[model samples]
Target: MSTPGRGLHGRVLDTLGPAITAGEYPAGSVLRTDELAQRFEVSRSVMREAVRVLESMHLVESRRRVGVTVLAECEWNVYDPQVIRWRLAGSERPRQLRSLTVLRSAVEPVAAGLAARLATPEQCAELTECALGMVANSRGHRLEEYLFHDVAFHRVVLTASGNEMFARLGGVVAEVLAGRTHHDVMFEDPDPAAVTLHVQVAEAVRARDAERAERLTREITEGALQELDILAP
Candidate 1:
């Protein structure tokens, strides 16, 4: 049996999510408890529970007697699933693509380096397996092979970073890849050079050559960005 809280919570989230993304409740707009409760036909307690979910996502913040207010873009949790969905749905502008690429360039190379120096043997083996699996999956058909390996490779890199904060970025990285995987750019003919680059990255990490691993990982990602035209030389 679905709990009343669960159903009411979903309705509140659905209603408020559209409003927030549509700019009906633009950043800094105050959300009133009574007004929202009446509009959604839910009790005040149920409305509060929905607001908590939004707050957790960094979409809204509660203030003493000021109620809940929409947060600025900087304050919103871009990694939040809801935020990612909204951004992709609202506008997948070139600038956003470029920004995401730039972020990956900055974070991923360091992660690779750290992984080379710190990853357990098991982690290294998993990385190699993922790379090999990718090659096999791409045989006669590229499909989503590269994308799956791409996300897995980076996820392990982050995990091997030995920093919880960096590892936490796995979700954001995965989301970015998943969002763009269906685009034509990612589905083009396989590039042997790209595949070789992945092999090189795995080898470098396996050899525990931190600098070499970092450089190779950077090259691979930068090449991808260049192919997408999201980065310029």
Candidate 2:
């Protein structure tokens, strides 16, 4: 069940965030609260809350003299899940995929190395279990379940790294995985090699083999990027 704030706020954010990212609401355009309230047929408070969320994302700013002004794309919080989802839904989705894939390739490999050195035994067990769960879900055609664990798998790796900055990337990993799955970038059946690689990476981390962990992680991420290229329409 969704909270009222999430239900309404997310709807408004989804509507406007994508519009902003897609260039429907270009920079310098002012968004009036009264107009938005009327347009969405919601209460002023709900409209204000929606705008406040967008402002926090750095996609817009409410000024004293002026209304809420859309900022340039560069000003937007690229790491925000909502912003990433909006970008993935836009015409420039391919570009977003490429950039995010590169970022994952760069960051996750290093994260895996750190996780191997710093992860607790419990974290390693969780990662191994998550990877194994992926195989079961994939075999059963439980795609949503598979994706949930897949996201969990990466999130665990990020969090296990013990570096606060690396831990922050868990959401980014979730965004890419969810966005890709939602867009049908992932097929119904999981790749056996990918699953195998995931298990290998987990085992490497468990064994404290940092070199192997990093190498296997790089392989997994690189494979994903290749798949994205193949799936690009």
Candidate 3:
């Protein structure tokens, strides 16, 4: 719902967030509100809101005399949406992808397994619809379709997981996928085998086979990572 340029505060935050993340300010470097407002062509009030957002993200700390200073990486709230966006926009390094994939590997399969045990009939139907949508859109280079189904598929898995923590992972998943989408990294042909694996996971969930669902989910995620490596190379 948040459109680019609509909110001055968000735009300012987006601009400054990346600068800090990319080390333009660096750790302990002071950020001047007036300088940033001038740089981004925004008013001080908008700039202040952006600074507040950054503070919440732990990217910058505001002090009375020193202005705002960038924090160390360990202090950052990586899970914050703005922080994730900044990271994605700051660089395109394989190490970032690898780190995200590792996180996914740890979380998604367990989510899938839990969803298998907990999904309601309606959720199962929605999951099937999402999978079928993927198959339908796989024919041409329908990137949005792929992304839609891909996001939906994962959302269902998270919902089925019956854990609020797992559901909260949706933001991270969306952020990573948005980056991949911007890079035109979704499968051009919609890998049938991958789609089939998704279906298998869906079926396992429908059947309440938690173990199979988890195993299939892991396989699907790992396969995608392998393909990403090949493509990025």
For model 3, the stretches where C-alpha displacement exceeds 4 angstroms are 5-7, 37-46, 92-94, 181-187, 230-233
lDDT of each: 0.76, 0.86, 0.81
The TM-score leader among the candidates is: 3
TM-scores for the candidates:
0.83, 0.82, 0.86
Report the C-alpha lDDT of model 2 over 1-233, residue by residue, as the tens digit: 11223667677776777899898988999989889988988888988999999999999999987999999989989988667767877898888878888899999999999999999999999999999888788775677898899999999999999988889878777867877777746666788899889989999999999999999999999898887773455
- Report the C-alpha lDDT of model 1 over 43-77, residue by residue, as the tens digit: 99998988888889888898889988998777777
Instruction: Give model 1's TM-score versus the native structure.
Output: 0.83
* Candidate 3, 1-233: lDDT as tens digits: 23464488977766666788877777898879999889889899989988988898888899998898899988999777656666766663455556677788789999999999999999999999998888888778887878788888998899779999999888777665665766646656767888899888889999999999999999988876775673343
Ranking by TM-score: 3, 1, 2
Best by lDDT: 2
Give the residue spans of candidate 1 off by over 4 A.
1-7, 21-24, 63-67, 92-97
In candidate 1, which residue pairs clash? none
- Candidate 2: Cα lDDT at 110: 97
Candidate 2 residues lying further than 4 Å off, grouped into runs, are 1-14, 41-49, 89-92, 137-142, 230-233
